[model samples]
Target chain A: MWRPLAEAARELIDLCVMSDVDEDEVRAARADVEAAVARLRKVRRTQTLGQQHLTGGRRRPWGNPVIGLRNPIAPPLQVSTDPSGRAATEFHCGPAYEGPPGLVHGGVVSLLLDQLLGHAVGAAGRPGMTGTLTIVYRQGTPLGDLRAEAWIDREDGIKTWAKARMIGPDGVTAEAEGVFILPRAIRERSPSSPTGHIG
Target chain B: MWRPLAEAARELIDLCVMSDVDEDEVRAARADVEAAVARLRKVRRTQTLGQQHLTGGRRRPWGNPVIGLRNPIAPPLQVSTDPSGRAATEFHCGPAYEGPPGLVHGGVVSLLLDQLLGHAVGAAGRPGMTGTLTIVYRQGTPLGDLRAEAWIDREDGIKTWAKARMIGPDGVTAEAEGVFILPRAIRERSPSSPTGHIG
Candidate 1:
């Protein structure tokens, strides 16, 4: 589906080229098609029973594996769930994650935050998935040896909030707040217990 | 693999069925395995093959798509070559990109900036992909109406700097600064052309 659109945008450029359109005019048309392509590229097919693709982005209209990816350079963190919420992990970034020649890409910071925050949520008691996560990138993260710290911030009846920070050798590179949810069924499965009243 | 981890975590939930382990001890141990499971899940086998699964929170490794994009949700911005250094058109984001239920997802904001900045490089008489993009989400972004403005900020031969701002009905939801980089070959491809002056 996106291929034709890509071709159409390309054709529009060809059209502009044929019209002896000045550079400015050609660009105007080109930008229009390009913008549309960008918009269309993001739409996913509806989640029908027969659909092989998932609900959203992974169901990229064109099925282009590369574009379907979120960040192309982030590495997943590995940690041991030491029978308590504590764990340690490390990962390295390759040139693929580089920005400014050697600096780490900022999007990668947010990526790490989600992973760590999810860990924090799981540690807190209610573990499922992130409903929302936000980040503040304070400084440029060096491409190598980045470190992340995460801890449970608070827990509500069914939702748990966590905070996480990513640090590079220079200093803190990013901070995040995340909301991790425990589906209702998971909560119901628990027997009556005299612990922190989840309610 | 992830399923077993989830099941194990669920089984270890300090259920009342296990009276042997002290309540406090069971709780602590359950916390431990859940945390480990969370980290382990980040390494999706699909993702290792370069398939994207998450959006807004984590970005994939570099050379992958923008972060948190488990699937396609936005359209692509098409681009055409130009000697005068200008873009094809403007890109827009609308209701389809809602985050926070009604606001735009932070990752969606970053994705738009990435696309616009990538286009800006071409408009600046250079062609490249986004090496790094940093988006500062100022406030919650309204879902219905939004506009994105991007243009080349500076060009240092193969490296082009671009800036993008996301405008909401009330004000700016976010702004981004990016580095767009042309591969060495692409920068050297048209050294003989009129725009070669940039090289």
Candidate 2:
């Protein structure tokens, strides 16, 4: 039920962005959307924050903008990890994520890599906050299916470094490197663990 | 009309992420969302892509995820520019953008900086594509009112560099440096112009 609703919401956004129907039709659609919103608000939310786990035992990121299955804003990328702790996912971008004409937004590319690198670091049993992320765009990522992957580069003291890249239909379009650091608080608490939980 | 609709959509997403009401209520909400989608689809959209302008003469980014007034996924950031081409905005992030409990998602931070840097470069009359962006997270950005700013650092031939930072209630939460480049195609098209256009 959530999946369908999310998909529907995505389609609505696409329509909102691209639609050029008459103003009357737009008004009608707005009315429908408002009504739907009113109905959804009839219930109260629990307000408890969601939990984030390391990739080794990651849960569904229901509200995540990159991979959350229940988030309409998400491309909802499905990530798969190998035994070696490398992470990868394949997903498609639509007009809703456009920056340049018919191309994926650079921020969207960064968002995908950030999450992928975080997962890769966690899968390797070292979870930490994102200290720094550096991304390079080699070419424009077209709005369509693409493949992305990330892996651990090295670990130095409290920092775990990871690398990632995105491959568009034509070729490699973007690459990224991220530094994940175990906060002082987390390090003190765990003592023995290389790192704590990641975001 | 678009603003209210976008706000309503944002509220709905927050509900979807945080709600823990009865299953019957969830089902009912889903039905309403589905109905809204069905009504929205009654009209076909004009397939023309939207135009993006340089920040020097920027238009409202109605579909942009960072500052688009009509985009629900956007924080709807309202950026103001100084005569020197510095860009700044004050906005709020709600629970819909949470990552680590009460904190703003790291990816969301990247997204905001990416757009801010792009605008800064464009406002400098040297707009280019995001070639590279390096971000350092100094602390967690809490999900609430915050301020972000960006400015041009330097320009070299085909590249324009910019710097930006996000300030939470406590202090600086994150900072970034971006390298924007004028692609060969764009450069060739507007030979005399220092840079053609930006995304």
Candidate 3:
């Protein structure tokens, strides 16, 4: 049911990212999109904020811009968690994500690291909003199949630290460390909470 | 000219971000987009890489993802340079950029800061690629009008250091420091060059 909608959205994003149409075609396409938006806006007014997950919820994919299966901005990422609770994913970045001539955008690299690190922390039973993130770019990440891995580094009270790296065909292209904070509401609810919600 | 193309692209992105359509509607809209893409692909084959800027080039608007006037992913940013060479921009983050509930996404903040800090370095006559970016999130940045500023902190040989901050309605929301490196090609071309091309 939702798969087709996501696929269509991905097609739309691809067109927007690299399409080169003339003025007449662009105007025509723009009008079509505007009409769709007007119709959709009517439906949105009837819906409310979706559900929030605390812990052990259904293992449904999210709509995150970086790793969400339903997000067109994301590449097709296939993530898995090992028994030891490390999270890893493999995917390919296409021309739509290009920043430099042949390299993936640096911000996109950060986005992937943030999502991977967050997932690693969540798998370790601690999830929170990003408090700080530091990214180091070792080399240009080319647009192609790549691998990423992340794991928990340490945990201190309400903060959890994690590190992740992106590997290109050559070698490590970027690395990151992040501190995620458990919200006050969650902390007040469970003093010894190991699993929490992620933002 | 390019304006209409950019405007159309922005419109397409907006629809992709928030539009809610049923399965049948998605299929119809997807077909429309696919046809447009077929025409646009032909047009793209005729185009080449656009222009590049060295030092003191005309301050023309670019299509950058974070601050480009033609980029829909960007919040509306109005920037100006001060006498001391600081770059400041004021803008608003809408729901389209939300990550956490009622707050702007951390990566969005980093993207804006990266662009702002990069612009500050370029304005100071040392455009280069981002080597490292370290961001500290002081608080959850609420979604609304905000202000950001960046400027050169120091420089050594081929490295330029810059700092930037994002302020929400309350106070400081996030801050960042980055080290940008002038490529060897640029450094070798001008032994003491303060400005180079940005990748």
Task: Identify the runs in model 2 with alpha carbons over 4 angstroms from their true place.
Answer: A46-48, A51-60, A183-197, B46-48, B51-60, B183-197
Please report, as a residue range, the 10-residue window in candidate 2 chain A with the lowest summed lDDT.
Answer: A47-56
Query: What TM-score describes the B chain of model 1?
Result: 0.53
For model 2, which pairs clash? none
lDDT tens readout by residue for model 3, A1-199: 3344445445544445445667776666566555544544443322111122213243343444565554454574667765344889999876555555557667678767877877787677677888899999999998779999988888899888989999999999999999998777666775555442355
Cα lDDT, model 1, residue B50: 21
Worst 10 residues of 1 chain B by lDDT: B9-18
lDDT tens digits by residue: candidate 2, B1-199: 6666667677666666765556666676667666656666676544414344333244445777777767777877899876465999999997767766568889889988998998888777777789999999999999889999999998889888999999999999999999998666656765444342356
- DockQ for all candidate structures vs. native: 0.03, 0.53, 0.37
Candidate 1 lDDT over residue span B118-155, tens digit each: 55565565655455556665666665545666777787
Error of 3 at A75 (Å): 3.4
Candidate 3 residue spans exceeding 4 A from truth: A1-6, A45-62, A76-78, A188-197, B1-17, B20-24, B46-63, B68-79, B82-85, B189-197
lDDT of 3 by residue, B1-199 (tens): 4444445444444444445667676566556555545545555422112123223253333434554454344444767765344899988765445555557667778777877777787777777778998889898888779999999999998998999999998999999998989777666775555542365
Candidate structures ordered by lDDT, highest first: 2, 3, 1
TM-score, chain B, each candidate = 0.53, 0.86, 0.76
Which one wins on lDDT?
2
TM-score of each: 0.38, 0.89, 0.83
